[model samples]
Target: MSGDPVAGVTAKTFGQLPDGREVELYLLVNANGLEMTVMSYGGTIVSLKVPDAQGNAEDVVLGFDSLEDYLSPAYRSANPYFGAIIGRYGNRIAGGQFEIDGTAYQVPTNDGENSLHGGDRGFDQRLWQVSAVDAKDGVGVVLSLVSEDGDQGYPGQLETQVRYTLTNDNALDIRYQATTNETTPINLTQHSYFNLEGEGGVEGQSGILDHILTLNAEAFTPVDEGLIPTGEIRSVEGTAFDFREPTPVGSRIDGDDQQLQRGKGYDHNFVLADNASDAKNGSDAEGLVLAARVEAPQSGRIMEVYTTEPGVQFYSGNFLDGSLVGKAGQPYEHRSGLALETQHFPDSPNQPDFPSTLLSAGETYKSHTRYEFSTR
Candidate 1:
């Protein structure tokens, strides 16, 4: 809170863990007064204040007000992922098993028969070292973490770094970089549930069903009963999965499609059509392609997602059944928030047709995704 309003970054103590480890919260404010708060604990994005058409600012992301709430048993059981960073493997790995160089490996399975978002205690549950950094056209913080070999049952000593920058043009740019001592699968993503209309609403009726969404994807990877991909990259044409145009999120969410039934909503990975090989490193802004766009008509807020990743997972907050209350002191009802996680496809290790997420020794993994905000 000690930085100037015209693009600055400041750090303050958020809270201390039960083990006496202190967590720091960094505030990054852009020139337009758009603010983002990130905490060292889990490298989580605590809050994002964005302005509506009327220039009124409000937090557009769903999260808890205090650290104790995040540590509660109920919260841990729900594992909504909130606004934390997912690593090792962002999405699911079938049966928590995979093979590399003919050597077999098995990770903890927390999601039914599949492994989800790393193990139970993934990057989202660990503390990161955070430092303020001066971005080219923004102010931000860099969070770094090192996972030892056999940590979370993954092979290799992985060194990872994530940068969150709030640019002057009201864009939150996220860049991920990692290097491993041995060959392993690495897919990282930011899991921030966004409502655009703000966190909680009247009588806990907040949901994202009214938001209009458009995905630059012609196909999607359908899932099985366990929500794991079926290895078939089916076309979305003439199906409920089609979002090529601006369509309401709830338009066909309740259809009789089996994919919708398995996911219970729009929780599928869309294969981006604008995949450019030159953009793999995400070093140049021109290399990024438009992935998805979400608009909240009620608030006149729009969020356009751009990324270099091959796929984007659109989760409509299916499991939030009013069991947990957010910072606004209101229960988070079903579909109260949504997540657009840009990364490689799910179960990539098992599906050879999907984009490869393998990171070999002496090679660095890089990815970038940007969320640009504006009013239509």
Candidate 2:
């Protein structure tokens, strides 16, 4: 626990689970007055406030105000993932099955016929043990979890730690660390739906269609009808998937392309060009590269994503309907927010050509992603 009196972190009781487990909410404030609220349940980021061009701070992430809403049947039925931490495997695995060293393993299939985001009960639903940490550059919270062998049908006793640091430079840095007693496949990522225009959006207009996005990638992995990667890394040239330059998110979203039709919008994994080679070459220092950049003209808020991962999952909230009410009682309409999840390629376990996600016994897995906020 952080005992520093001047530590920019505070905690309060968010709510209680059905099993009487208490969930704690930690507020991390940086020197620049940026605030981030995170709860112990699901290691979720409930709210993140950043200043716009006019120096007005507003919540930019979509989430519920209380833990009850997150536990509600309506919310569970939708399972939009919100701002939780996805783990074990961040994306879909074909048929909910994979092999490890000639041994076949079967996991729960929660998303149609494929296993999505670590089966039915993923790390997003786990109550993590959290503690405040006073870092040299900022204040933060560390959430830890222990997944016993066979949990979620994985073959390992995995111990994981995620640290959320709010730095003075107006950056939210997420660091993930994990270790396993047995060889297992692991992919972890933070799923935060960000609407730089602020939750519902500026004025009465909703949706992130106007947000300009740029991805530092030239290709993306196409998906099948079930949204699972087809093990092909195709070029994004002359396609709607091209975001090499700053382009409005909705400019070509509805274009007459098969990939666009399959995803309903933009829901695909982009192969990060900058980090791919460095990752393969084991160049740790040069591994962190700019993955994506987003700007909201309405609020003049810009966010840049840098990561050590080899890929980023760009989701335009294609499935968000007005069914779930979020912070300030606002309906989460379609395309209201977007997520740039820094992670390994989806279905890597089944894609023989993709980078391996296997973490051997006594080996450590570490990944870092930083979201730096600023105004133009």
Candidate 3:
């Protein structure tokens, strides 16, 4: 049973993997009636229920109802990293290859010629261990996992932990921390497709294409045909990529811009103007810079993204295709939802000009991101 809404953590066995390993689900609810359910498998947020303008709560994140669906071959085969924690690298690495300390390494080439979201089997597929739980400021669960040396062709053993905290202020705070035994590349992020219209999953139930979105970026990293950064940071002045002001996502999504055509939609990363270097330099608490703000007029739900990362990837869910069914047997259609992934610029390993994602021995990698929900 849920305790006082102020802060609490509840756990139960969710399901089992093919190998018979057991997985657990933790429910964290805050004072404002915001509830988040996370699972040990992939450290995923299976559901996030937030109150809307009328004070009615609904799940906003796209996911399934049963753990079996998540473990099924069909679900696994078609997963778009829905509600999972992405790791090792959150975005693409050109040609599935990179050089670290003069050593070349090959990663999983799951995305055309590039490696995406940590390769063929990433942290999203791993079973993380719950290390601690606290319900002070809010209900917080700390999930830890250690990626073995050379796992998916990366270097060193990376010991990482992600803390999911549901705050009384209706903020879902995700804090990432990691350390490696040797020099390696590390980028972690949450991959949640949110449809502020509420996770109805049925056709016409939600369409993020019309959601008003505002990104705090003056520039963006353009991509090539394969969606890999072309090593150039260009201004978004007159381009459709300009999201400096609040604009409907679909306003120019179908424009004749070459970049829009290349991505098939908005899948590019916007370079954040606010500097978060102070946080990376080991500050205990760093101010989370506003990255993006999205609002769904139909439901009157608003979500503001804050992070300490250098960039945010605004994905318009261009590939959902309606083949996969979600919670309560709801069919997920094209552009039904969207993902705002906060992280370092894509292909940072290959782009020396971008902020480095490399982590050295004895150096810790820390990142903070938050999604604050509300109603207008």
Compute each candidate's TM-score over C-alphas.
0.96, 0.96, 0.95
Top model by TM-score, which number? Answer: 2
Prediction 2 global C-alpha lDDT: 0.90
What would the per-residue lDDT of candidate 2 be over residues 19-93, giving only the tens digit for each residue? 999999998887777889999999999999898899888999999999999999999999998999998899999
Off by over 4 Å in 3: 1-7, 201-206, 276-285
Q: lDDT of all the models against the reference?
A: 0.89, 0.90, 0.87
Order the numbered candidates by lDDT, best leading. 2, 1, 3
Model 1, span 85-193: residue lDDT tens: 9988999999999999999999999998889999988999999999998788989899999999998899999999999999989999999999898988999999999
Worst 10 residues of 3 by lDDT: 276-285
Comparing 1 and 2 by lDDT, which wins?
2
Ranking by TM-score: 2, 1, 3
Clashing pairs in 2: none
The residue-by-residue lDDT of candidate 3 on 1-376, one tens digit each, is 2443545788899989889999999888877667889999999889999887888788899998788888788776776888999988999999999998788999989988999999999999999998547657777899999999999999999999999999888899899999888988888999999988887743454478778999999899999999999988899999999888899999999999999999989999898888523324223446689999999878899999999888899999888888878875667888888999998888988987788888889888888999998889
lDDT of 1 at 243: 94
Better of 1 and 3 by TM-score: 1
Regions of candidate 2 where Cα sits further than 4 Å from its true position: 1-7, 278-286
Q: Model 1, stretches more than 4 Å misplaced?
A: 1-6, 202-206, 276-286
